[model samples]
Target: MRPLFVIVALSFAPAAYAQEISAVCKYEYTVHDQGQKSGTTGEFSLKATYMLPVGQPLNVQVRTTKAPCYEFLANGDDMQISGTCSRAAQNMKMVYVYKIDRMSGAFEEHFSINDKTGIVHYGHCLPAKPLL
Candidate 1:
């Protein structure tokens, strides 16, 4: 009876710990862009959410009207969260890279289209309330 009870408890322990290791971070960014051809500058607000799962790639969902969710593999871990993803659209390849400091909440995002056009976003992030 004692051996059976011990085995059962040990089996359940890993699942509990895995759940606790998952994290979600929400961020709001001020987008800055200068027109490549027109040389016009503009600014706007953007929101994004990042989900990090244990032993798996992280995912980011930008809160835009028509943006697709992007997946990013673990890049580095020097006291920060960082990832990169790339996709092709309209005959152009796009790359996105982001990093957030764990202590200062400072966030930076870079988006490049075919290595020709690029935009950088700067902002901060905090733990977000879980959605019901």
Candidate 2:
């Protein structure tokens, strides 16, 4: 039985390695406050990277944010991926939520700072290319 146990463990060894999901997403967004829209619209891009391991919460890093990392939750299926990230600082709080359709690369994002400011973004993401 010891030999059988060893074989079973070896079979699952490959899955124990870390997995990563990385993407470069671009957005065209408008700022809003109190139901009023800003006169200017802008475009921005963010790079999101997540390190996922079995039996552990995802470790995430997003570029173009004040914080290096945020608390994130993911709800994903075969067709779509959705998640939210939130961070807080002295007397201020920020939240960002996004949904991406895996097939078409379409995505929507909402970012809010405190209670009074918000921005809505619409765009697409593609897999990130390696720097080197």
Candidate 3:
């Protein structure tokens, strides 16, 4: 599952979302070509949930990366979280980057591994099954 879409999920955010928020969200996703200027490989219907539990690190299970990451929150308009996932046999590593824009309610995420990268636009925020 791609956990990248948690960025724009506030499409269903609560009324008080602008000032504060708390929830586990699964976002709708569309796959864009990593670097090629042409067609996309395919679409990912299943996405991972993302969360920032107080006093704990950010948590999510991404298909591309397995490492846990930490979220960095600033009081203003931006937030970020990132970590790496690796492939032992290939000796490759993918770095996942998740970003949120509070002012615009925009979410963005991308990861690069094995020379391929992907970015997904999160469409909405709704409750989803917790990652185990």
Q: If scored against the real structure, what TM-score would every candidate get?
A: 0.51, 0.54, 0.37
Off by over 4 Å in 1: 1-66, 76-78
Q: Report how far off residue 32 is in candidate 1 (Å).
A: 5.1
**Candidate 2, position 124, lDDT:** 60
For every candidate in turn, the CA RMSD to the true structure comes to: 12.6, 11.8, 9.0
Clashes of 1: 0
- In the range 1-132, model 1's lDDT, one tens digit per residue, is 676545433422332112311223334444445633223233223333334333344533333221332343433232455666688878988887777565444566678888865776665543333331
What clash pairs does model 2 have?
none
Tell me the deviation in Å of residue 43 in model 2. 8.0
In the predicted model 3, the residue pairs found to clash are 7-107, 9-124, 9-125
Clashing residue pairs in candidate 1 (N, C-alpha, C atoms within 3 angstroms) = none
After aligning candidate 3 to the native by TM-score, how far in Å is the CA of 104 from where it should be? 4.7
Residues 1-132 of candidate 2 have per-residue lDDT tens digits of 676445433422233223234445666544555555544334334443444543444433344332433334454433455677777889788777777665555677778878645876677665554321
Candidates 2 and 3 compared by lDDT, better number? 2
State residue 17's C-alpha deviation in candidate 1, in Å.
9.1
The better-scoring model by TM-score among 1 and 3 is 1
lDDT of 3 by residue, 4-114 (tens): 444434432322222344324334554565533332232122223344342344353333222333333222222433334333335866555554443233344465566
Of 2 and 3, the candidate ahead on TM-score is 2
